[model samples]
Target: MTSIITHNDQELLKLIGERQNHQAFEVLYQRHFDAVFRYVFKVMQDRETAEDVVQNIFISLWKKPPSLNHPTLLPYLFGAARNQIAKEIRKNKWNKEQLDFIENTKGICSTDEYLEERDTRKLLESGIQKLPQKCRNVFKLSRFSYLSNKQISEKLGISVFTVENHIKKALYLLRQSIEFIVICLVSWY
Candidate 1:
């Protein structure tokens, strides 16, 4: 019998999907756990939560392995980790620092590295356009114009808290929108 360790990710996935092969599942888990865990840990900044998120990712994969045309599962795994981290951030109401951390980490994987810079810029612009008028204005002022929260508040005649809230909402919405696009792009390639 051929060793499952020699099988590629697609073959392993097929084994798991069609035969419910735990060994194949274990192979995949062992192959990806460290990279996925490291990514989740970096973004989460909490070992236990990161482990939980990574564990859930593998659990979901084991439960229903996705049918992918691609040979490698790295993109899918990274994408799953990204989504899981985002969900955790939203659920836990993590601070902006964590959000920024995830944003910076997006290009750490090969999947995101393949995105054209111009395409990413366009998607970000589109997401910004989709924001509410005031929120959009605040985001632009803060991000584009390099204005501080106090400066944005004074210019918009809103309180600093309101300005901060607008920026957060804009970021949350933009992140969701851009993440969806990135996922589609990853699946495409």
Candidate 2:
């Protein structure tokens, strides 16, 4: 008897979780899909990967709606998107252009430099993984996704100040982790 749109996120989530209500799920999906898609697209920079990631997020929600302590679901959805993106990256499934660029660069750099660069990249990624969860998410959205502070704030449901702080913390930890590589590179040149 009531319009689904009138329900808040928690109420709709309850309907989906308790009753397996398709209408509630659809309403929730419609409410957040565009924002989630745009966020994933920006991070993935590939339309197909972005679509798949967004679809999976919604599918997972429908299959098993999460119990949320937060007032809104945007943060959870975004976290799921980040996890999917990380999985894709870890799979080493680079697009053709990325692979081509890597292949093209092999001829330009010395083997030693190339290897060192690769190692440095690995160290940075390791450092990112070691970061606090919230900090890592903010850093990836800011650096890898190339999103503005305002954009990240809106997506993560955090203030811009919080975004900046996380970015700062991530950078500091990453710099510490890779300081030796930077010193070596500088000394070589």
Best model per TM-score: 1
Candidate 2 lDDT over residue span 99-128, tens digit each: 444334333333454456557767888889
lDDT (CA) per prediction: 0.86, 0.80
TM-score of each: 0.56, 0.49
Scanning candidate 2 in windows of ten residues, the lowest lDDT window is 101-110
Which candidate wins on lDDT? 1
For model 1, what is the alpha-carbon lDDT of residue 22?
A: 94
Candidate 1 lDDT, 1-189, residue by residue in tens: 899999989999999999999999999999878767867777887878988999999999999999877667877888899889999999999999988887876756564453454367678899999999999999999876657899999998999999999999999999999889889989999
Candidate 2's C-alpha runs over 4 A off are 95-189
- Give per-model CA RMSD: 14.5, 15.4
Among all windows of 10 consecutive residues in model 1, the one with the lowest summed lDDT is: 109-118
Q: Report the error of model 2 at residue 122, Å.
A: 40
